[model samples]
Target: MKRALPILAVLVVLLAAIAVANPFFLEPAGFLAFLKRAAPLVILAAGQYFVIVSGEFDLSVGSLVTAEVVIAARLIDGDESATWPVIALLIVIGLLVGLVNGVVTTKLRVPSFIVTLGMLLILSGAVFLWTGGAPRGALSEGFRVFGRGGLGPVPWSVLILLAVGAAAIWLMRADFGKTLMATGDNERAAALSGVRVDRAKIFAFMLSGLAAAVAAILLGGFAGVSAQVGQGLEFSAITAVVLGGVVLGGGRGSVLAAMAGAFTLEALFTLLNLYGISGALEFTVQGVIIIAAVAAGAIRLPWKFTPRKGDAHAAS
Candidate 1:
């Protein structure tokens, strides 16, 4: 809770600023709509939180999201009856990709950075080959409801976001979450203490994949079909996580902070758009945030004493 305060505070300030800039934002309808818009990225951040806290990275999620949307469109082809089935297939594809990433990284001893980057390229190439630079077909209205429609006054995406957020909080409080943190902090120590480091890391990757699948569903419905639907989301999620004060190399951070970071980011973008900022600069902004956050984390106070040789040895 203590670690999460800064990000949460930032979210509040952003929301307040939005309200000031756009008075409509203070209305219930406006706020709910904002949540709906931010849902996918927040969920992605949650998933990324798991992997980062477990001492790994998932660069493939953005590409995986693109693949899922493309596959859903081709398979469903606007057939209402196919909505559920295709959604299920998308989930399976996400898990399978995550599983393969996990297996290759852990079992084959490949660095996660390389493995996921490769997966990202592989998925991106597959999407291009399948679509030939242009996506075909359309999403069913039934499917679109999840992204654009709502239950009465509330959007379904908002509901889904709440559910995902709750689940992430719960998961991080469970035994698995503790073990995951331990593994990230020190893999060898975790293993010596009987933790299944490989399995934990693999599961974390799978969770990230699942998050990407869900994000694709919302995006497919909300934004319609596009070859670039999921472009640059990987960096966005990472930036969000870093903004939440999660160290890049992992081992520390709260899930709530991570989610708050996502919301803060979305709010920032919204504010920027309202102020007439170019959308093209989103990537530049994210890059700056990531670098700033990581650098802030690396800073040490001048008053902190340097460790003596024996002190370092004892600490280790």
Candidate 2:
């Protein structure tokens, strides 16, 4: 929790700023609406945190989300009865894609960067081919409820976000989290300590995939179906994780911090919109953030040097 303080502080400040800019933001209905919009991204960031903390990246999640949404719309086709079944299928597809990415990276000795990038391209191409440039079909009202409906006063998306956030926190405190941290910090040492490094990493990728699937479900309901629904989300998730102080190379950072980072990003965007900033600048902002955050982290790292044999002898 200590590691999460900075991002949490930033989040609070952003929320306060929003409240000032728009007094309606202080109302329960307004705040709940903000949370609903932020839920998918927060969930995505939580999933990305798993892979990043395990010293790997899953670039395919954005494409995976697109694929899931497109597939869900096509299969569900406004059939309320098919909602549950199609959702199940989408989850399976997510796991399968993650499994393939993980196996290729860990077991086949390919770099995760290459593996997930390849998967991203592959999924993108496949979606284009499947949808023929435009997605078809519509989500049922029942399917949309999770993203658009609320239980009396509370949005379902907020409830789902809380559930996912709690699960992520709990997971990080478990033995698996310890092993994952060790693996990311030093793979060889973790392996020597009897940790299943490869397995842990594979599971991390799968968790990311699961998160993408859940996000896709919510987005399909909230934003409706679009070929570009998941566009740029991978970068957003990475930026959010970095904003939370998670090192790009991993092994340090808290899940709470990561989720807080997502909220912070959302709030920043909202504030920018209120200030009449163009949304196109969002990508530019994210680019600057990625570079700055990585540089800041590098600066904070202690400098280390090992003396050469001659220098050691001279010192001795």
Candidate 3:
């Protein structure tokens, strides 16, 4: 319950704002549209939650999403026949990128923050070099289905988000998730317990990459393709995750809440747009939220680790 309070509060606030901005927001379609728009970010947040709760970051995801969309367009080129294979290739690429990020951070002993940042730059530069300026080709209809298509009244993206959310929750309740939490709580102790610390972190990063790829597919369909479609998305996902109450250094959050955080973010943006708020200020809000969330997490450490006298610290 404690894990879900922040998300619940955010959700209630956002819903109230929506109701105030436009009475129609209470209608089914309004809510469905909101869910559809939020689907990608929610999925991405779940994926990012794995990495974050495991004690790392995956900055490459934003550019990876851009790259996935671009590569999809170039390879598909309106050829419906190419969609599945190209998607498979994109998944492989995402896995490879995640694998590389994981390896460098775990085996090479580099900070994941630095390694993923380097990856973000590398991916952005590569996309720029390959596309020149405008992206080539277009996404075929079949390929676009995941993003914009739905079954009668329900969007496929929403369904997919539900599936991923279920899976993420299941993973968090499994042995791997338990091991990951232990690792995050204390890597040395986890390693000593035969937790395969390196492997857990790698898997977390891989999940983030996989999330980025999935987000890219939906975004490509809804927002359309561009050289900059996913710019700043990493920060957005991270912010949503943090707002869900997941601590930055890991071992302290819930996937369900993280998904809720994504929804809250989308609703907030929609409310802002309804109120004629400039989109430009969105990033400023995210920056402040990220810092504040992290700092708030830090403030709890003393209480969480309160020790008996002469155990660890001398009370003032």
Candidate 4:
């Protein structure tokens, strides 16, 4: 029941603001479209949830998405015949990137934040070198299908989000999930219990990378290929996860809650746009969100304890 509150609040605010801003937003199509647009970020948030819940960070996902999209475009080069191969390559690249992240963080004992930060720079520089500023090639029609295509009235991206959400929930309930949670709660204790802490961390990084890849595919289709297609998405994903009530240091929150946080963010952005707010201010908004959420969590513990007058004297 506690897990449901964040989503309910998210829905309430979403519905109220959308309805108030534009009555058309209440219509099915309108809402569905919003879901479709928000799908990539939502999925990204889910991926970020895995990393965050595991007590780590994955800052490279944004640039990884960019790299994947750019690589897809250049390799496929509008060749419908090359679509399947390129996509497979993209997935492999994503997993490999994740593998590297996990291995380095666990084996070298470096902080994930630093490792992923380095990865972010590496990927961005790679993209810049590969594309030379302007992106080349075009997404094949087949490739674009996932982003723009749908099953009857439903968007594929939205369906993927639902499926991923379900999978994440199931994962959190599995042995791996339990151990992962334990690892986040206390790495030393988890390792002492024979949890294969390194392996677990590796797997978490891989999951995050896989999520970024999937998001890249959808985003590539929806937003089209560009050098800047995925800029700052990593931060957005982290913000969404934090907003979902996942504790920053880990050992708290549900996957469903994290994903709902992503939806809430999108809805908030939509509301912001409706009220004539500049999109340029999104970074500022995200900054506030991160600081405020962390601060709120920090204060929550103190909130429940009011000082008792003369308590020390009574004990004496």
Residue 38's lDDT within candidate 1 is 96
- Can you write out model 4's per-residue Cα lDDT over 112-216, one digit (the tens) per residue? 999999999998898879788778998899999888898888888888878988888899889988988888877888899899988888998998999999899
Query: In terms of TM-score, how similar is model 1 to the real structure?
Result: 0.93
Worst 10 residues of 2 by lDDT: 301-310
- lDDT on C-alpha atoms for all candidate structures: 0.89, 0.89, 0.86, 0.85
Worst lDDT run of 10 residues, candidate 3, spans 306-315
Tell me, what's the RMSD of every candidate?
A: 2.7, 3.9, 2.9, 4.3
lDDT of 3 by residue, 1-316 (tens): 5677767786898899888889888988888888999998898898889899888988888899999999999989999999999988988888889999999999999999999999999998898799886689999999999989998899989888888888998998899889988887678978998999999999998988888888898999989989888888898898888888787887778888888888878887887788776788866765675577557755764676634224534555
TM-score of every model versus the real structure:
0.93, 0.92, 0.92, 0.91
18-58, model 1: which lDDT tens digit per residue?
99999999999999989999999999999999999988999
Model 4 RMSD in angstroms: 4.3
The better-scoring model by TM-score among 2 and 3 is 2
Q: Candidate 1's error at 133, in angstroms? A: 2.8
Backbone clash count, each prediction separately? 0, 0, 0, 0
Clash-forming residue pairs, model 3: none
